[model samples]
Target: MKRKSAKKTKTEKLGLIKNILLIILSFLISVALWFMGTFKDQTPVTRQLIDIPVTIVGENVLTDKNLYFNDIGDIKVNATIKGVSTAIFSVKIDEIVAVIDVSSYASGEYSVYPTLQNIGTAVTTTKIDSVDIVIEDIVTNQLDIALEVEGKPVRGYEARPDLAEYESTVSVTCKASIMEKIAGARIKVNVDGKRTAVTTTTNVELLDIDGNVINDPGIKLSVESVSVRLPISLIELN
Candidate 1:
């Protein structure tokens, strides 16, 4: 009876070990299934976005340093982004922001790398290695304003160019390279068929020393217009 009881106990122990192994295998299989379901699509994918605009910041720095930038017209670049398939595919062209800070840059051309923003967890490897940005030194000058007569007065009246009175000087602001080209500011008054003296304010034209109009969108004046008074002289007949 004792030998039989010992053999039964050994069998019971083997059964218990088998049962424990089965339970652990089942738990491991369930965990593997859950992990596969949760992260099956977590593999990263890449997408290319075109024409991503570049925004410049810290321009007040340039202003403080007396520097200016040219019209970098519609500046754009392409970026190769990588992330989870769902996240990367949902990225929009407008949502991605590329910025470059020009505060530390001096007056010259520079190849700048833009910092990407607004992309949650995605990564960017832009196609454009670096954008070429040109910084120019600003040149400001004070020029004397002159009154120019454009048209003749009525039959008995003659406009005297020398008798005109107006603002003496104005501050002209332009790029340093174009500063020497800008000579003087003049307001041309039209006195066609006018018997009375003209007194009003009008916009001035930037003229080179050779009397050619220098029109530039970047040019700014101290005032919008200059006041003028031109006295029409009556011609005397002998």
Candidate 2:
């Protein structure tokens, strides 16, 4: 009985050793697989950025009456990259897009986002050093036009309509800079609702696209209203 018990003890010890060795071997194999996956190859990747929509809001635009605009869909920006095969495989195109916010711009010119900014120039240390991008505008029309007037007198009496830098119409539609001053604006006057020539001191308004008046809000006119000189006898008429 004593001999049998000793043999049993030896067998149990051997079994325990075998189990520990198997565990260690399995762990080593797992580590080797992980390392291999980290760096398997080196190659270039080309991905497409599809329909990345963005919105731009701007102020002081004219789009009413005869002027209008049609908003286009969100813009699309694409890029092609080259890098390590392992890193490239995990490189997500969507992740790259997550770094840019171009929704604050209006219908005009703008530069690409600088955060995920593609490498414009390549260096010797990196596989892919630059990125190229194409940006487009999404256009929309807003109906709020403001007309501004500007022009100085020849150098004498004040201007009647006060044409020295003021909004003509509440709004009009055109390019931003073009809306400042319009050409060929006129003002007509008729005394006593009759087509007669009369000179008097009165604050009248000018014409705008909305048919509003620019009163004599303290801004003096270099040229006064049209007038006709009258004789003393005519001035004393009953």
Candidate 3:
């Protein structure tokens, strides 16, 4: 009876050991499959991204020389990128920046090549189209600054410029073509419903030959603002 009991205990121990071995073998197989699936090389993908913005790097190079771009023809491009599927799909439109360096070039027209940046190493830029750009030299000019009063003063009051106290001259720098178009600079003062003299500082505006305001970002003025004193007086009715 004791020998039969011992034989039964040995059989139970063997069964338990076999079950544990099976479980360990299954776990190892699962781990190997996961590692193979996660670390395997993926197929390369090619994507054509369009209308990526072309930026001017070292724009200060031109600005410091008192020069500016007259025409940046076709300031955008289509990019062809080749990379692993995962990386190409994860890229954002804004993440790609196309830049053209004009630092070494002077004021003139030329065909420039643009380079891409911020794209990860997993991806490679295959192709980028070139662009034509024009840079122009800026010219300086001095013009007489005038003050114009807008809106009628309160009833029985007249507004006039205090010619004795104001900035009469302003120096302006801009492209030569633009400089030729500028007729003068003026500061506009509003005198609505005012019976007393109005004294304040206001921004000056560049005007074309026909008195239309010239709004050119490339234009630089020595003084951005000016002080004005609009002398008001009682109008004696005759």
Best first by TM-score, ranked: 1, 3, 2
- Candidate 1, residues 1-238, lDDT tens digits: the string is 9999999999999999999999999999999998986685587777777777899998899989889876677788777777777777676667887888899989998888887777665555535547898888988888888887887899999997788888868888877867788878888889998999998888877888799989888778897598888899889889
What is the TM-score of each predicted model, taking all chains together? 0.74, 0.31, 0.56
**Which one wins on TM-score?**
1
Per-residue lDDT over 1-238 for candidate 2, one digit per residue giving the tens place of the 0 to 100 score = 9999999999999999999999999999999987776545533444444433333333223222222223334444444445555555565454453133334434444444433332222201122222223233322222222222234323332233322223222222343323332332333332322222233332223444566553423223333332322111112235
lDDT for 163 (candidate 1): 82
At residue 204, candidate 2 shows an lDDT of: 24
Judged by lDDT relative to the true structure, which candidate is superior, 2 or 3? Answer: 3
Model 2 TM-score, 2 decimals:
0.31
Error of 3 at 174 (Å): 3.1
Of candidates 2 and 1, the better by TM-score: 1
lDDT digits (tens) for residues 34-123 of candidate 3: 887666537687899899988887778888987777656557898899888788888887878899888777877898768887778888
TM-score of 3: 0.56
**What are the C-alpha RMSDs, in order, of all predicted structures?**
4.2, 13.7, 9.8
Q: Please count the clashing residue pairs in each candidate, in the order shown.
A: 0, 16, 0
Q: Which whole-number lDDT from 0 to 100 does residue 21 have in model 2?
A: 100
